[model samples]
Target: MFLVYVDESGDTGLVNSPSNYFCLSAIVVHESHWQTTLNSVIGFRKELRASYGFKLREEIHCSHFIHKPGDFQRIPKSLRLRLLRDVIDFQASLLNYQIVNMVVNKKNKSLNSDIFSLAWQTLIQRIENTLYHHNFIGSNNATDSALLFVDKTDEIKLRNLTRRMRRYNPVPNSFNLGSGYRMMPTQWVIEDAIHRDSAHSYFI
Candidate 1:
């Protein structure tokens, strides 16, 4: 079995809200099927763009379809709905997957540490623990490996926000989630496109 950990950027609450709560989540998908699911997502979006003269709204981060500074929700209803549908279709297309969500309250660390860090750690810790309980995943000789997909961070453009991520704890072995109370080294993949769309991207 393969583990694909996911993370997100941007405030989880209503867009433009003053709060500093960004949503961070981690999910696991079968390695054997990860590439297939990813390719499907790429294909779906490409098809939509070719079929429709206009681009979808949720692709807000997409350079081809970015919203003005003050307008994020002003996107057309049809485009927005399509975006949602695409996410749903992505999960349906996946062979199998499991998701874990972590909401970071960046405003005050009093209640919790950084959410981004927590999200990453949680996935590591949780996955490791799960494995310890279930023995090695694939085979007797199989070594533990995990990949994390992180959405690209904006340094110059969104420097302040990306800077916040710098606060996240850097672990030498962030590959495996905490396994059976023991920390093991595993591969971690950090893909920039992994974000709020991830939950939707890999939903059950």
Candidate 2:
């Protein structure tokens, strides 16, 4: 079975504000690989702490390192930059995994807005193709389930708008690991628990 996780970035309200440019990030992996991937990242973080005693999650006094606070800052800037460059250079050796990402340019407006849905459609079409063609995923399977980790900073706004579109509320911030779509707050302590398993699974 295929496990899909999603997340979103940027504000869901007015575009002229400081947090403009709404982005939705998603990372889907085969269920078979879920535990393997999560365990790997978790183990790596522990090694970092043991080897150098470098406090990874500075914000919280926790030991299980899947979603440690300040992990974005903790990871060496050089490594982050390298991935950006190596990823584009067709450097398979450097890529962490095969993934796809889509973003709604809120410079124009909210995703549910008429203008934004145009762009949103294209993003969905691409994702549909990716999921269909993935060998590990196997699209011919009659049943499919998708998960979403939406950044509802504009909870009141997005929920109302999306309900109008989907005819119901998408999902709430009840994160059941990879069992179902988790609508979570975009805070470190909360968002970090999802980092390694479905790190970019913010939106669908």
Candidate 3:
């Protein structure tokens, strides 16, 4: 089994919105190393707290930590750079993990459906492709099942979208116009929708 933890950045609103881009990011981890990965993340957070006086309870959002002037602002520039560099290093050191990101430019074209839903559709397609590749390439240890975990902030909306995708194909007919009889990948997703609060979702 594998776990695909997802989180999004930016609002779906296009009018009077601050962000120009919306992104859906998923961190895929195999079941065998799940506990170790969780522990390593917790330990990294603890290290940050001890060494940099960073708050453990606060989430490590990239934009807020790097661009905005708040919690990380009080720290020296050199230290901030060091902390971020170390974080990148730690992420690179992880084994059997994959980070998949889908970024959309909200202003590029008019969307047929809500931006959030479209983003989810694209994300699911990418995930399905990953699973398909894995099943074919890693035949000896092919993944049998996978679960998706999303931030609980938009639980209702996310759950509704998941249910809709599971019940019927959401991909537009226009997408498959060129490819004959190509099925969309949403069916591979598990029906149960799991939501976790970002405050406690360290692995996400």
Candidate 4:
């Protein structure tokens, strides 16, 4: 089994929006390595607490951390940059997980386009394809089932989209001679995505 943690950046709005692109990122970790991976993250957070007086439970919002907003104001800019670099290095050092990311350019999209749905659909398809081919841990034949945990920003919309896809997802039939799509219901992912508050869940 695998646990998939998902988060998004930017807004779905195409007009007068702060960002022109929307990105969805997923971190996939196998069941066998989940505990060790979590322990490593907790250890890293403890290191931050000891070195910079950062709280272990404090959520690390990238924008606020970089901009030094609110509670982050006391942290010097130079230390913030160093901390960011350390985070990058730590993430790079992890070997038991996979990162899947999808970005939608809203600049060229129509005003009526559903940017959120499109981005999630593509991302889910990519994840499904990956799991179908490789769902093993070392020599063990683990179950290919995966569970998704997303930041609770659009619970209803995301749940509906995921449920619909599980029922009747379609994909291009590359093996066919003609241009046609084929039903490809989700196989690896189980049930609707479980939403969580990012502030509460360190994994999110």
Best by lDDT: 4
RMSD (Å) per prediction: 8.8, 12.1, 3.2, 1.9
Model 3: per-residue lDDT, tens digit, 3-42?
8899888878788779998888888887777898888988
- Give a tens-digit lDDT track for model 2, residues 1-204: 455454555544563556656555555555555676666545555654564454435322222233333554555655444433432453233222345566655565544575334333333434444544543243454444333344333345433443343332233334554455433212111111122322332112
Best by TM-score: 4
lDDT of 4 by residue, 91-130 (tens): 9998788889999999999989999999999999888888
Task: Please give the lDDT score for candidate 3.
Answer: 0.75
Task: Please give the lDDT score at residue 45 for candidate 4.
Answer: 93
Clashing pairs counted in every model: 17, 10, 0, 0
Cα TM-score per model: 0.51, 0.47, 0.83, 0.92
The residue pairs found clashing in candidate 3 are: none
| Candidate 2 residue 136 C-alpha distance from true site, Å | 5.9
Candidate 1 lDDT by residue in tens digits, 1-204:
555555565643443446676765566666676776667656666776665533433343432333342343545656755755665676565555666666666665554344544544545555555554544333332444444454543323333332333344344453576533432433332222233343244221
Give the candidate order by descending TM-score.
4, 3, 1, 2
Angstrom error of the Cα, residue 151, model 2: value is 5.4
**Stretches of candidate 4 above 4 Å error?**
135-142, 174-178
Better of 2 and 3 by TM-score: 3
> By the TM-score metric, which is better: model 1 or model 3?
3
Could you give me the TM-score of model 4 versus the true structure?
A: 0.92
lDDT of 2 at 196: 30
Question: Residue 114 deviation, candidate 1, in Å?
Answer: 4.2
